[model samples]
Target chain A: MDCYETRMEPGDRLILCSDGVTQAGLGQKRYKFGWRRSGELEFAQNIIRKSPEISAKDLAYAIAFQALSISPEKCTDDISCLVIYLRHPRVLRILTGPPYHKEHDHDFAMLASGGANDVIICGGTTASIIERELHTKVEIDLNLMKASGDLPPPGMMPGIGLTTEGILTLSKVCTVLEKKQQDKIPLAAKAIINRIMENDCIEFIVGTKVNEAHQDPNLPLELELRRNIIKRLAIILERDYRKKVTVNYY
Target chain B: MKKITLEICCGTTCYMLGTQKLLQIENIMPEEWKNCVAVSAIPCLNNCTSENICGAPFVRINGEIMSHASVESIFNRIRELLPGEGEE
Candidate 1:
């Protein structure tokens, strides 16, 4: 089992494990593995030390990966994992770079300089491009390099479907912006949207609400842009997939 | 002669388990079967919660679900369905 301790607000507790724990001691045959893990708290703690860096979600997967590495050879043993966390946080990470030109530098500098928690643009030409464009440094998730050919349209990322819920979930994770800062949104989104439109999986949705929302004076420009961008992205996603896209405003 | 059509679901669950790569069936098939088989892709079979979701890496042939939708297995199945000289 993988053990975790919550360090952030909204104190949460989590336990992760390989399928071994679930398969080991359960009376029922069907989904018994899940139920057993649900009740076994102390046993879960015995497997690993507290992790201060990994989130509850990542902790679970990390444990699962660790177990897979150590498990007996030649046996599948139903490798699995269990994650328990009181609450999950809404996280948004935006990456931008590979400047178009030395004269026309590009980066998600708008977000970085706007008081984002992390700044990841590399030093040198990459950092220079971002620095020239925006005010602050944003932490870069190096893992993004693994991303392959053109990103799928707005809601077409792997494991994300075209359903209303899926669309809403993806929208929540992505940072949106008004057309004014059109240059600020991730290039991947635009590339993906173009492909989605090409495949007829989605279409543009523009109406008084979307138009008016961007015009709202009460909301900050960033917040307003954030809100409407999601709507536009959703309309495109729904149109292409031929489905209803839903959103939850918090 | 019986023609075969293969359809793979790209649904959320399947997609997460790496169904995008499963779409290489057309390329994997032998040269001769190209004219006899038609391969297509769709998003979501709504089979997310199933335990087998992780293994699908799934194909539907003539409307029948083929389990363990691996590249090798699919190649064999396509071969079996090809129009040929006689009974096996």
Candidate 2:
């Protein structure tokens, strides 16, 4: 973040964004959310409309929040901004990231552990991992943790990279569960099937290397294996969702 | 009555990794377990991937960490935690 300057007029609406907004990852190229002030204004309007009843302060916060939420790795630079209600919008100046911790009320830990809806399962290798990591019997804690926001969010994982495959996988899986429950599938069956499927997936998946390796020579076998696993998952997801799954290597 | 709370981080990596589906875990809960569990969304927890290209999109369960997670794993973990749920 560069500087926070503001000039208040009667009904001037202002908007600001961090360097991250301009540095979004588009393959090797970096791009801004919007190029021009008009476009930025429209982006602001979209942000305002994203959530109803949000005040201007919260709206600005959400814009920043959502931008960062795009990808942790993608946001190399810090983001700082100051929007003023002036006759016309102005950049003032753009800053990179925050200097120090201000009010991140939406702490990552709180969201990961105590979010609105969550599921915790215990079985097979996954159960073993949970037991090993948390040092508790998977059987006892799975349900307890699922029912309670006693855990962290998915991003806390150690390795896995954020990829299109991962995103689609999440969407597809959520769709399956939502539909299954709506159709009154037996909880036991759902759990059993889910456990069987999830146990095969490696935790802390590192997709960036795999993504890069696909194009570059000397790809590691481990990276290839991860890609294959994700591909299989995508196929299963496609079957589950009855849609064509697209996997982006990059 | 056992009280439980689950927070799903909708962070970029988490969202991409299918943590979004964790948001729907509530629907699958048997009526009996509903009252005991609470779910919500969170921002960031500073849990980074070993390699930005490789790691990310993790989750924590009951103060326990589950990194590089997936929807299937998350679902499985939740089923084990819910009351009267899990493999027989």
Candidate 3:
């Protein structure tokens, strides 16, 4: 075995593979291009180049799958690929609920827009505050909510990472984290959970405002206060997931 | 009555290019065609690369790829698919 070492900078990706991937499609008539075989290396490079944001595990799967797909009839070797993506630690800031006092709406909006790499605004009213203060529009595509099961659709705004309905989405996030049943979570909650898992530091801006609609007895018992839900999320993220969490209530 | 599925790409590359405006397509869609269209935002279509990143803001209409997509262009394609009365 030959060993080599090189300096890797942040945002660099390292891929290690077995001979199966490199030698795939060798001597195959379909892969013949003059004298060269259209091997898995080319296919892996194409997948990586096209989907630069792909996770390391997904990259490995793609490379191995490509190797298997090429000349599956004569596949005799075991294919293996390992990918390591190096990057700086990321911080995710989540803004949920609305400020208790209407006077602090601008303050809440400014904090949200203040240079966070990943920002998630949960709650329609919370999003509206940001939209009003930042002069940006939050567009919620109702069609995406078809499978969300009573949860309002997710919204998108310029310069914000993610926007979604509050309490319900947070409840789903908590459920998915505790039960590990990601398949049953709604799309918006799934997106939020995915973002949370990817980051090292989590900062939550928990607005203290209480929506009277949630207090109705007709609603599900799980529809608790936003502050309580965020507290639960912070606990799970910090204690269970070992992430650095900071929650500031306005 | 089958509705045409329209998936607007909201990936970082596509959003920066102009998909943000396309998210409002529902607002401007013809009232008669509203029932026939289903629109959603997808994270990425994986059609973008360093070489062809300029062709971003892509959308899928009934699983068919449409690059350099705009709300107007999407409406045109939907018209071709549905061809409602009085629509050119």
Candidate 4:
């Protein structure tokens, strides 16, 4: 074993992929997602090309799943990705819907805006309500984060905040939590999950208010209530990461 | 010999109220007592709040809750719980 040391500059992404990613498939003849025979480099480059500002969790998934997407008969190997982000203090606040009743919007906004360094809005209507009530504009760069089907990319809310699809993304996040698997998560959920992992303390201000529009019978059971998803995520964060997770359901 | 699992609350409130100083208890412990105790920092016991009987600066010894915890209080409890040991 050789011990090597190198200085990492800012904006550096170190991708340490296992052989399953490098020498994947049958010889050099096999590659997935339209990459050259030099599959490993191009494969990773492809994921990065899709979303250059990709989170560690998502990037790994993109590669691993693509490997799996290859004809299973050809690709057979264990995949593992160890991502290390230089470690920074992150305080993320996730705001879902407004309070169950209309009267509590004021108090909801107050607590919702409480003490988090960063914010992520899970619902479109919730963003509108926050915009109206708090007078903050929700601006999003769709190109920054790719959008999945029926779900738009995460948008920004001017000041240290981002917004995502309500039931659609929340449903995906819940599945990630339930399955206890982080791979192949939806883009928005992957971003939030990675953000959560970046932070030491996280606050969740979930509105107990249920939206009739979101009560679609065709939706997944957990998607019906954002509160349920928030609570469940809180539990996982606390139990798994041992982070200071405070979920104040307003 | 009975062992003690001590969980120190590092919740925001408790951390603000002086949880850092509580680590000193482990340092001042007698060798015999130190060997029997395992101290770990807990994110939040969900007990510290402005409106509850439990607030920050908490310590739990073998699942025993110690609210508004202090080095003196925790040591006193340890002395009481120590097997066959009497207060010095």
RMSD of each candidate? 19.9, 20.6, 13.9, 20.6
Predicted complexes: DockQ each = 0.01, 0.05, 0.03, 0.01
lDDT of 4 by residue, A77-177 (tens): 66666554443456788877667788888777665475776778776566767777888766544233333333345666676476775665776776676
Candidate 2 per-residue lDDT, tens place, A1-250, comes to 6887766765555666766554433243333342334444566777656753344556577556655655446566665555554332111110011112234312312221222222232112222222234434311122333432312222122221111112223333344543554443333333323433433222222222322312222222222234454455456645663433343331
Here the TM-score of candidate 1's chain B is 0.77
Native contact fraction (fnat) of model 3: 0.03
Higher-TM-score candidate of 3 and 4 = 3
Instruction: Tell me the chain A TM-score of model 3.
Output: 0.81
lDDT of 1 by residue, B1-88 (tens): 5578887654333433455466555665678778888776543343333334444545688888876677777777776777663356
Over the full model, what C-alpha lDDT does candidate 1 score relative to the true structure? 0.42
* Model 1 per-residue lDDT at A84: 56
Tell me the deviation in Å of residue B35 in model 2: 2.2
Over A127-216, each residue of candidate 1 has an lDDT whose tens digit, in order, gives 333434653322222223124222211222222112111222234333332232344334334443333323422222211112122233
Model 2 agreement with the true structure over B20-61: per-residue lDDT tens digits? 456566676568756866655544334544344244455677
TM-score of chain A of each: 0.33, 0.25, 0.81, 0.57
Kindly report which residue stretches of model 2 are placed more than 4 angstroms away from their true locations once superposed: A1-250, B28-31, B52-55, B82-88
Lowest lDDT sum, 10 consecutive residues, model 1 chain A, at A156-165
lDDT of 2 at A186: 31
Candidate 1, position A136, lDDT: 32
Report the lDDT of model 1 for residue A173: 30
Q: Write the per-residue lDDT of candidate 3 for residues B31-85, one digit (tens) a residue.
A: 9888999987654465656556667778999999999898778888888899554
Q: Residue A21 deviation, candidate 2, in Å?
A: 44
C-alpha lDDT values of all predictions:
0.42, 0.41, 0.75, 0.64
How many clashing residue pairs, candidate 2? 73
